[model samples]
Target: MEMNGSNSNLQSDNKQEAVKNPGDETSGSTAQDESWMKLVNLQLLSNELECLICSSLIFDPLTLPCGHSFCRICLTRAFDFALKCPTCRAAVYMDPLSHPTSVALKALTQQLFPE
Candidate 1:
């Protein structure tokens, strides 16, 4: 199977478009809506970006042939003995650490969780 590039459940930030309520003040309502949406979106992002091994936000993300994403450090530790994916049981190479960082995922995660 072909190893695909980064995939994210959060998808895109541009999709957030606030609906204007009839007779509502555009300035105040829009601002409040934006703040609310941001908080909600951040929460959605936090759920999707966790590393399976660490059970926290991912850093130095790496994508494996099985299409699983994980922290590079986590993958290193998990692959210490087995040459397979921990989640799917798909066989991976022993030296999976040599793979390049998942640049698209790294950028997306950093953008959402920049604290």
Candidate 2:
């Protein structure tokens, strides 16, 4: 299948947007607004890290061929019912081991929620 460069570009844009210059001056309201935005972004990111099947933060993320990711255990359990993707109902031919863990996603989740 053709690669989608747009996803990479969007990820880079999000990385840029997440960074800020602490030295930059801002009014009280502006600072508060920035804080609120940061909180909203954090929540959105947390939601993205959550596994649909388990309804918890993904421990070992595994991205299916359909481009949907889920916790490894959750996906494995799902496979017992049907060899189909939980999100899109796409047919899954290979075993769960064939799908590699998303290292970057796992590290990001660990870093963000160290507790």
Candidate 3:
């Protein structure tokens, strides 16, 4: 059975070669998709978190009592004309001029869109 022995040895060598050079193997695409999805998710977050008035990535983000958010400077300038939530148009004349900064969202923006 010399031929059979030679065939087995050839098969073993092929298996060893495949194991040594695994980078040529085709892996599942989930890893690639995951990276792509991460980029898309970051883009979506950047879009959603942008200031509605300035249409830019939010800086010094402040949240109104009505849950609308804007940059602190934008809100102040808008209030000079009319005191209302820029997005929702909820009257905020009675509320304090100084709104609380959205700590979490601001931190996230800083992380995603760093200088």
Candidate 4:
């Protein structure tokens, strides 16, 4: 009976030691997983900031003849004075009613500003 009690006590001590160990592999893996998740979340958030006009993410976006971006419809609406580039104020042919939204920009906008 005495021998059995001693063995049981040793097993309990081992369990406690295992619990106290800070360098356990399970804890290390959990920490790494958390870091990875944070990185993924940041990456996902970076997809926002799409231009409202083109409905796409702005990439090498040019300023329109109206001092607005080609992606913004406000520039296109100013074509009544003459078809002109919004940013440069240069004379150019543009159909005010033909403004089209960029699909890529739309997707990026949705990602950045969901709903």
Candidate 5:
């Protein structure tokens, strides 16, 4: 009798392939898990961006006219004699700050920089 191909070798190859790429079910579960984690991270960021001072989501957040906003009062305290936005190094007057905050941006930030 002569063996044209080694049965053990074929079996080994199959096993290796399977290990490299698991079945559809396993791959699907991994994908689902990744999606779930992404969503959770988004939620966390949303919660965080909610202004700690206002206890509400930041809206038209002033760039501190000092680049930092704090529910109005926070910005006022951060203000220096020159009246410059602390964060952006921009000049600001007594004028109120205003800028739009986006839910999408918050989510993206969470996704890109997951803690």
Candidate 6:
């Protein structure tokens, strides 16, 4: 009888271990996958929000006539050198410092990256 009880206990322990181990591994894998996806998405967003000249998050974004957007400070500095679109090389006659900020884009960027 004692032999049978010991065998049953061992079998139950093995069954619990089997179930617990797989669950642990699966949950760990799922967590890792979620974190990886979040990091990839953040990198993509960062790339989109990055200033072409400074390669940093665009602050005080300015939209040009050619529909390209860049940070006002970066564009102002570039215009100081030569008043032309950095992305397209189109002639920019207007003063970059007097250009208005792209309101929708600025709001979106601020909401997404407040820091």
lDDT of each: 0.78, 0.84, 0.81, 0.56, 0.56, 0.87
TM-score for all models, in order of appearance: 0.67, 0.70, 0.67, 0.34, 0.37, 0.68
Write candidate 5's Cα lDDT for 16-115 as tens digits: 7766777655333477777998999877877765555466655434434333444454555555444666556577656544434444544544565555
Best TM-score goes to which candidate? 2
- Looking at candidate 6, what is the lDDT of residue 66? 97
Q: Lowest-lDDT window of 10 residues in candidate 5?
A: 59-68
lDDT value, candidate 6, whole model: 0.87
Model 4's TM-score against the true structure: 0.34
* Superposed Cα deviation of residue 89, candidate 5 (Å): 1.2
User: For candidate 6, lDDT tens digit of each residue in 34-66?
Assistant: 799899998899899888999989999999999
Question: Cα lDDT for residue 55, model 5?
Answer: 62
lDDT for each residue of candidate 2 in 1-115, tens digit (9 for 90 to 100):
1246887887777555545444444222366777998999989999999999999998889988888899998999999999999999999886776678999999999998886
Clash pairs, candidate 2, are none
Candidate 3 matches the true fold with a TM-score of: 0.67
Off by over 4 Å in 5: 1-24, 28-40, 43-60, 64-70, 97-115
Task: Indicate whether candidate 4 or candidate 6 has the larger lDDT.
Answer: 6
Candidate 3 on 38-86: residue-level lDDT in tens? 9999889988998998999988988888887888888888888788887
In candidate 6, stretches whose alpha carbon ends up further than 4 angstroms from where it belongs are 1-29
Error of 3 at 77 (Å): 0.8
Flag clash pairs in model 1: none
Residue 76 accuracy (lDDT) in model 6: 90
- Of 1 and 2, the candidate ranking higher by TM-score: 2
Q: Give the least accurate 10-residue stretch of model 3, judged by summed lDDT.
A: 21-30
Which candidate, 3 or 5, has the higher TM-score?
A: 3
